[model samples]
Target: MNWDSDELRAAALKLLLLATLRETKVAAPLLAELEELGMVAPGTRKGEFRLLAQQEDKFRRYLSVRWPEFAETEQAFSARPTLISAIALRALRRAPLKLPAGITQLNRKTWSAWAGAHSKSGCATPPPGILLTSDENLRLRPNAGLQIIGEQGGTLDADVCRALFGELIVPERGFSRNWHVTGVLPWLVLTVENIGAYIDITIPPWLLLVHAPGRNTLLATRFIDRLPATVPWVHFGDLDPAGLDIALSMRGPQTGRTPVPWIPHIAFELLETHSLPLSSPWPTQHLPQKLLEHPVLAWLIAHQRWLEHESIVVLSGLVEDVTKLAEMLRER
Candidate 1:
């Protein structure tokens, strides 16, 4: 059965719970945290319930009575995969988990795919309208085809945010042979390297999409020259510590625009909160040097690390705080 299918949901949930248990003990406190983050939720706690255990009878009893062929946890994890409950951590840190017989390869590739496919962490599936279409290349398009459901300052949720990273969305007007530059970007540009290197069937090292290497200066001087005084140019790339650092670096003297949050905070908060099985662990140090000088970012630099999309999701709240950060820095 497919990982996302109803038939596999119970197995996935059991696996996630079991995996988390390897590290921590599953109990009420952990269950409370999971509920807050929308991990695994059940009715009022009565007596000592078998949360997660190897006892076959105990495990079966809890499922048979409380959850019938579980299918709801996936939806919970899908929207908020980073909401790591104690149960999850407990399961993961426990005994080594084996992916059933013949399902051997627990390689990075498998883990990455599983995280993307399962609601246990990250998005359940890629967002709609964001496609690997056109010369069959990955493209980041506008918010043309996505359905905005959330009422936050941003409507695009984590899934939508992930989907639209570097993939093109809206096609074009007049049906002209075209490439789309979504949003009123300040000065973001795309360049092709090793272009035309793949003529025959050999795949080239050239990726369909990547962050513009240099900061606003080189990026502006070279590919995109003109820009309005006040513009929001989001630099989207892979969701990693390096990606967050790069976004953080593209600020200050670069664009001259007071760094508003153009990235998403929801992504990182969920990633950390859920303690999702990482393809790569979130970096302890990822903020740019200049940002590291700021007290708020410096604090994040000190011990906490924000993941991708956090800046964008939390931008509105951050603008007012920038002044506070400056004040604190000045005192220092």
Candidate 2:
């Protein structure tokens, strides 16, 4: 089942098209393949085939196992066969540049048109070249992998911006590809993984706070890339494997000069009291090598405990601890 192969995918799609039809002629070799796969049985006449009435569930189950995306398409087709068929036919005729729009251009329909007309949350499986949003709106994937969200302020170079305007929030429009912090560099750059913790944590005049948001690190890494190599970097996130990996991902390639986990001694001390039990088994296989060797991470793994950044932020003396962390990094 090398589903990644283009030839295989095309063959699978052809089989799926046959399955969708109530009564349709199929190529003999294709029918033989279907019969072998338990989807169809040979008919009385030669070169003829028919799907068994009792094998409908089996056929669907087989599709679900072999091609889950096709299974989703099959479900979507049942709801709106005409729309689905039209989209499929349009895709087959010519690949669409965007999504439903490229296929539905003549009708002057938007991608959200499908949602409004058919009550579908989204296209279950987009055609080969098209991309769709959750609400079935056609959208091209952004070149920027992840958008950076954070707050900035303090005495910046006059050229950077006209006025500080107190603590300036990063504009919702996000930074451009060439965007970088220009002016007096912050004493420390702190990347936070969770929005709640990022907002709750106190930001000092000498600190630049960035929202990394889980495993998506493109914008965060780009922001860090623009910073002076001498600027100390640190990450504050969950105490789980994902948090450790995020910190590792943001690390500088220059060996010793990289972002370090901002877990202070207080965090380790509070772990036993504040930490939550692992809801699911820890995925050890995916852990970064550095995390696997980390004494704190190892202890957490052994004890099956994880701490959330929000929990640590809510603790007393957290502000002091962060201040102390900045001071220590400054001294380093």
**Predicted model with the maximum lDDT:** 2
TM-score each candidate: 0.23, 0.51
List candidate 1 stretches off by more than 4 Å.
Answer: 1-232, 236-240, 245-288, 308-332
Q: What digit string (tens of lDDT, one per residue) describes model 2 on residues 101-138?
A: 44512121334354222334343443454444222111
Q: What is the C-alpha lDDT of each candidate?
A: 0.35, 0.58
| Model 2 CA RMSD to the hidden true structure, in angstroms | 12.7
In model 1, state the lDDT of residue 100.
Answer: 48
User: Candidate 1: deviation at residue 16, Å?
Assistant: 56
Candidate 1 residue-wise lDDT, 1-332, digit = tens: 13223323333344354433221233444345444644443534442222333444444443445454333444445455455453443333333644444442233334434434333343323233332212213222222232223233344332355354523322222122322232324122222111221111121112112224323223322212223333224344334455455555553343444222223233333443532233544464545455345443333444444433322333344333333433343354
lDDT of 1: 0.35
